[model samples]
Target: MTRLPPVRVARAATTVRTAVQGLTRRMVPPPVGVLELVSGLIEANTVYAVAKLGVADALARGPRAAADVAAELGTNPDATYRLMRAAAGYGLLHQDGDRFDLTALGRPLRSDAPDSMRAVVLMIGDPRYQSVWARLPESVTTGTAQAEAVHGVSMWELLDRDADYAATFNEAMTRLTALDWPTVAAAYDFTPFRRIVDVGGGHGRLLASMLGAAPAAEGVLFEQESLLPAAEELLREAGVLSRCRLVGGSFHDRVPDDGDLYVMRRVVHDLDDEQALALLTTVRRDMPAGATLLLLESIVPPGSGPDFAKTLDLDMLLFAGGRERTEQEYAALLDRAGLGMTRVVPTISTISLVEVRPAA
Candidate 1:
């Protein structure tokens, strides 16, 4: 006699349980109510005054009277106070009588601070990016990205086709990259590799920094041909031009033929599994035996915490048609490319270096 179907068995068990115990409820935090709803929207800073005044940068060291800060920034004292007070209430600053100081939470706003978020803030606060988020509702409705709708093109295409937007975007990345690469250079070991290529290395920012940190390591920076001029200038500015070669190309087609290491920073997440694996396969095939592949990106966690990268993960979904991945997902992607995860290097609270190599 064949056994009853599993669904039928489950339904019979559920019916018996429901008869025994009428109903059940699970606990969860209640949704935000009306007052909280208004509070959330109304609190969004208008004019982003603290950023405008460079208040966070100024107060990073210690507290100062409003008059002094105003004098320092060449602003009216009373206006500065109001802005500072608004910032204080927002937890970016603390107030003591008429004096203003950096709260512990505001330390990340310091331009010189490690993993400083000022650049990120600046990019987000800009009209272009802000506008993109504003249209997110429409993006969700149509399953098309805001950038494409607003600008009449995809972000990647615009970044390549439009010189002005490319310049501004690259400038923002340059600022953030300048702040990050110094730490990455001083921390990561690059002594084993004679040649390393930074594929899809826009403006060659990371390559320049890596070369600066590892003096003996020669480098190649591969970027879109249209972006080559800017990448060359970046290398020149980095003072590593003589030590490196510039290859204007696409990662989808080819990478440097012979390199021990292929470093792609913040590139993998811009692709889905198929595209990501294709890129990985190309890198694996191109890289010499006994080589390393370092994917410098933040690893998405399994469950929700106070994940700062969550916003970017959403941006990946809306903008790139991509999303951040957990370690298990990365393992599968690597396995598909005949590579394996050797180790993970946490560079900071927000970033990690995923080390990969060919399977044995």
Candidate 2:
């Protein structure tokens, strides 16, 4: 049987979820439905608690009594049972008598899982992020990032100061990239480009994958000086180090020029309109007349229906004073920067490749 494309599968799943939600709202009183929505924080924290406690890893081998898991984790037995029971209610685990087993949904919480989300859970649920989110009202009122207000520094500065938090943040980004890179590599043809430059490329994983797809193309990984060492190591492991050059600098100021294709993934979404335009202008200044700029980003759809990009837009506002944009918004931004959006190429992943060229 021919399998449906992932994009179609995702749309189908969203439709089903929307129908189920509608049914649920109809079945419950308005106040009850609203209250249920309010309790989402509890559910999110529960998942974070279990992931932090290594409960999923404890049950990786097989089902085990809650008390046994607590013993293995050196926690209070009764409390562990309650937490595991709560997790079961959330579909992360299955309870049988006093024992609990990790559900398929919970397997990704394990650190060793191929699609592990442990770092993402920990990063979002960390007290630092939570505290910044608590100030969302302030962010909305002032149209500014709350991270600076809460942490007394920008998010990037905070990352530079806290090594542990930086490591977790980097790993979370890498994990997210791992899920989309293969789809992106297959979605676009890179073989025609002799030089590929990945602007703000972190960890160099995406660049490595691109170079692998275009064996004849060399790559330039542009990032902060502090991140170049790690990117170098990853490039070396991918066996593309011989063909890749690691450049250390801020994209806001400049980027290496004369690349046949410039790729920026999830980078523009981290800036407000003015900053984003400035960055695009910097790229445009150096872009060759025939070069292409491929921006891999989640374009906000026209309607107000549920989209991960919408949620991420709010997160960006709260943390970095950035916002996700729609296709028209992107086109407008590119136009102001002397560039024109040629087309948008959809990938199996949430991100789409926005193909652009310098305006005449």
Note the residue pairs that clash in candidate 1: none
Give the CA lDDT, 0 to 100, for residue 32 in model 2: 93
Best by lDDT: 2
Per-residue lDDT of candidate 1, residues 28-80 (tens digit):
22353445545653344422456646877788669999888999899999988
Which 10-residue span in candidate 2 carries the lowest summed lDDT?
1-10
Candidate 2 lDDT, 1-360, residue by residue in tens? 233367667678877998888897879999999999889999999999999999999999999999999999999999999999999999999999999999999999999998899999999988988999899888889988989888899999999999999998998887888778777766689999999999999999899989988999999999999999999999999999999989999999998986989999999999999999999999999878899999999989887677788889999999988999999999999999999999998776678899999998
Best-fitting candidate, scored by TM-score: 2
What are the Cα lDDT values of the candidates? 0.75, 0.92
Q: What lDDT would candidate 2 get against the real structure? A: 0.92
Candidate 2 Cα RMSD after full superposition onto the native fold (Å) = 1.9
Provide backbone clash counts, one per model: 0, 0
| lDDT (Cα, 0-100) at 121 in candidate 2 | 94
TM-score of model 2 vs. true structure: 0.95
TM values, all candidates: 0.74, 0.95
